[model samples]
Structures are given as C-alpha cells and as structure tokens.
Target: MPRRDRPRRAAFAHLGPLDTPIPISTGTAALTLETDGSVLLDVNGVPSSHLHPDPEHLVFEYMRWMLLVIDRHLAELPGPDASGAASSPPAPAPHLAHLGGGGCSLPRAIAARHPRSRQIVVEIDELLAHQVREWFDLPRSPQLRLRVEDALGALTSWREKRFDVLVRDVFSGAVTPPELTTAETAAHADRVLRDGGIYLANCAAPPGSGLMADEVATLSTVFPHVGVIAEPAHLSGKRRGNCILLASRRPLPEGIDRDLRSDAVSVRLARRPQVEALARAGRVLHSR
Candidate 1:
C-alpha cells in the first residue's frame, strides 16, 4: 500500500484548452446551488451527490442505505455492555474504502460518526476532486485519503485484506462501468476485505433493466451471502431508483433481514433466493 500512501500530486488527466471540449464523464465538476442552501454535484448531468450542511443528513436515499449497511457491520467499535457483567473496551477505528468520490459526502459522514476510522476514496477526476476539496469540508489525509485513480485500479493496487468495509459507487456517466460490474472486480474486492468484511454497491438501474440482477450474479461468483435493499416499489420492479446491493463471505448481521425493514425505513431486504430469481434471466460478467 506504500505505493498509494505517497504524497498526493496534481492529476487532472481530462482538462485541456478552451477549444478542446473534454468528455463529460471525466470533465471538471459543476457545482449547482440548490434553493434550500444545499449543494448539488452535477457530473455529466447525472445529479451526483447532494451535500447537506449536516454530514448526517444524506440527501440521497441510496447513500443513506449504504451507510446503514456500513453501520450494521463496521461502525460498531466495541462489544455492548452486559447487565451486571464486565464491559468490553472500545476498539480501534474501522478501515473503509469508497471506490468513487463524488462530493465525498459519505466519507464526511463517516468521519463525523466514526471520527477515528481510516478511509480511502479513489476519484478518477482530479479537477473535480480539487473542486470538491475547496467547496466542502472533506477529512484531511491519513484520516481520509483521496487518490486520483481509476476505481478498479486503486482497489487492486492496495494490499489484500486491508479494509473492513468497501463501498462501490463509481459510474461512467449514468451506467456503471462494465468493468466494475464483472466478477474480476468482485474477486479483487473479496481479496481487499479482511475476514468478516462486507461489500456494498450503489446500483443505479431502472426496474426490470436486469443490471442489478446481473451485478448480483457477478458478486455471487465471489461472496456467498448476497442481498438487495430497495424501496418496495423498486424491489417489486414497479419503480426506478438506486438499489443497494450487499455481499460478504461471512453471513449478513444477525436478523438483518427482519431488522432493517420497517415503515420508517420503507426498504425491503431480498436474500439470495429472491436475488437469484431476479437475476435468473441475467448473466454474470467476466474478463475477456
């Protein structure tokens, strides 16, 4: 990991002269001011991260669901107290990774919640990263490191079993990069996670599009426990929105299937059988 721990340098690979128009996917970010004083991150008009002044206020529902998954597994530092029994000491901060760096709202939220957790975010757009740094209050290096590199490249470059939680949020324009949805990426992610670690993907696809199911199939190649969390409408394939996919070698948190679904959350948890049925018509992606 020393190779990636080095000093951060300028890495604007897509910028050019005024006459040259860069592709929107990797171009400079456009910060839009919302009416309510919040900020919107627009990358190629995809309506990326929405920044709330309060880190705890994640505007996007999918992002909140992602944090919920992380909190269930990685955020709990020490064992809970026992009635009339000894209490476990506080544990070290968790290690987390974010494959895509939008406005880095999630990292900021994690920094606020788990102050000591070490995090690394890989952003392919250096100019956008710099802009986000100047606009928002992202955690400084060592605590939350930002690397200007491709998501897959950065993940593979790191040493094996280095993170407690890995979150995949990268996308090209709107659709996820095909490479990021393949079994190869999942295999490397499995290697990057320590024992009992978990993986989450922010899947953006229309209901009945089959992208989510295919991605689930891809992940099934690596991890045994896999599930999907989304609104009832989306889970039923009657709506379109972001669906959070969870995968891990270890089983999902105890009673998680029943724990997270409530009127307050309004999200459904579809276990392997349901997920397989959803993806039964889809195929897993593999290296050429």
Candidate 2:
C-alpha cells in the first residue's frame, strides 16, 4: 500500500468551529471525564472506550469478556512448574496489534495485566490518538505504541505471524467499517497472527439480524474455531448491543464456554456450529 493510494480523510464538518475539537475520520471524537476520574472516548456520541486510572478495573462488560478470552488462552500455555524448582525462564511477552486505538482502554488494560506484552495500535485518527496519549498517560512504546494509519493497510503490510493477539475494534459511527468485516480482512488478520494465536473483535448488530452470523461465517472460513459472546438477552434478540467475536486456528480451550457464561457479565457463548446456525439467515460478507 502506498501513501498516495490511502483513503483521504475529510474534515468533520458538522462540528463546525468547535473549540479544539479532536478531528477523526469518523465524525468528531471527544473525551468525557467520569466522576471516578476515568476517561471515556466518545466517537460520534458512541461510547467507544473507557480508560480507568486503575488498570485492574474494566468498565465495559464486553471488554472484560474479551480479556477473559485472552487470559484463558494465555493461561493454557506451558510455564514453569508450580513448585519452587529451577526451570527455564518464562516465555517472552506476547505481541499484540490493536486495529483501533480509540481511548486505548484495552491496550492500557493489557499493559497492566501483562506488563511485558508489547502492543501496537493502528488508529487512523491522528488527532484523537494524540489526545488519548496526552489525557490518558498511556504506557509508552516498547510497551504500547500507537500507529496513526489505516487498519487494513497496516495489517496488509505486516509480516506473517507478527503478533500473538489481534484485536479489531475499529468503527465508523456505530458500525464497523464493512471492509474490516470481510473474508479478505479476516485472512489478513490470520496472516498477522501467530499459529495458536487469537483474533477478537467488538461487533454491533441488531437482535435477530444476520450481521453477527454473517461475520462469524466469514471468520470461520479462515479460522478453525469461532465463538460469539454476548449477553443472553442480546443473544435472544431482545435488544441490540456489542457482541464479542473470537476466532483461532486451534480449538478453544475447554471450560471457556462455561466460564464465559458464569462470569459476572454472564454472556452467552455461540460455538462454530451455533454460529453457523446464527448466520444461516445471512450471507457471508466479502471485501469490497
């Protein structure tokens, strides 16, 4: 991909003559300070990310579930014996690539949970990225680096197996950019992730709609295992909300489904077969 071929970012006109508005490709993004001192990234009025001063705390239910998915997978990795004994050193920190920077809440949380994990966030909105850094005090590079570039372009240029985890949370308005949800994009994600690595995304869809099912179908084309987690009510088509979609080259570890359902968030887990059924009413989306 060449700089000249990248999509042109037009200025947000609706936010005319605002006081230092944070200009982003997706409308106008602004930060709201919570009474508890947490920072919220609001993109075109949608609550995108929540950054808490205490990294241990996760303000969003979907994000917590996402962490649980990552934690369970990482925990399965073989480490030194539990007993006090001489053993090989621990494995190097996992490398993470975040497709969307937003408020960098997840990156910040990952930094806190896995202090050594190296993270790079691809955010198209440069002004919003700068604001997030200045306001959030996000962990600096070598720990977490924010790359101001298009997510797809960045992913396409990356070498195979460059990251242990890949997160796609980019959104334009309330919906994920259609290009990011296509099978081609899923392949690029697969290319960048190491074998046994995981891919997670935050997806929005109406209840009973084929959006989520179509997305799962698309990812299943590339990854052997796919799972969709969301509140039972949301899964039942009672309301619209964020659903966490996960895919991996290997089968997901055992007990993950149970844990996800039993967690505080109590999300419903839809496995590959179930996911296929869910999307049976929809068509697989392809790259434009």
User: Candidate 1: global Cα-lDDT?
Assistant: 0.78
For model 1, residues 1-288, the per-residue Cα lDDT tens digits are 242464443322232232222243476456655555467777776778887766666788788777777778863435434453556555556889999998898998888777778999999988777767766767798888888999988988989989999999998888888889889999999999988899999888787787877888788878998889887788777878789889999888765556566326688788567887866756888977
Off by over 4 Å in 1: 1-25, 75-90, 255-265
Tens-digit per-residue lDDT, 93-158, candidate 2 = 788899998888888888977887899999998877877776677789999999999998999999
List the candidates' TM-scores in order.
Answer: 0.83, 0.85
* lDDT assessment of candidate 2: 0.80
Task: Tell how far residue 278 is off in model 2, in angstroms.
Answer: 1.9
- How far out, in Å, is residue 14 in model 1? 24
Q: Which one wins on lDDT?
A: 2
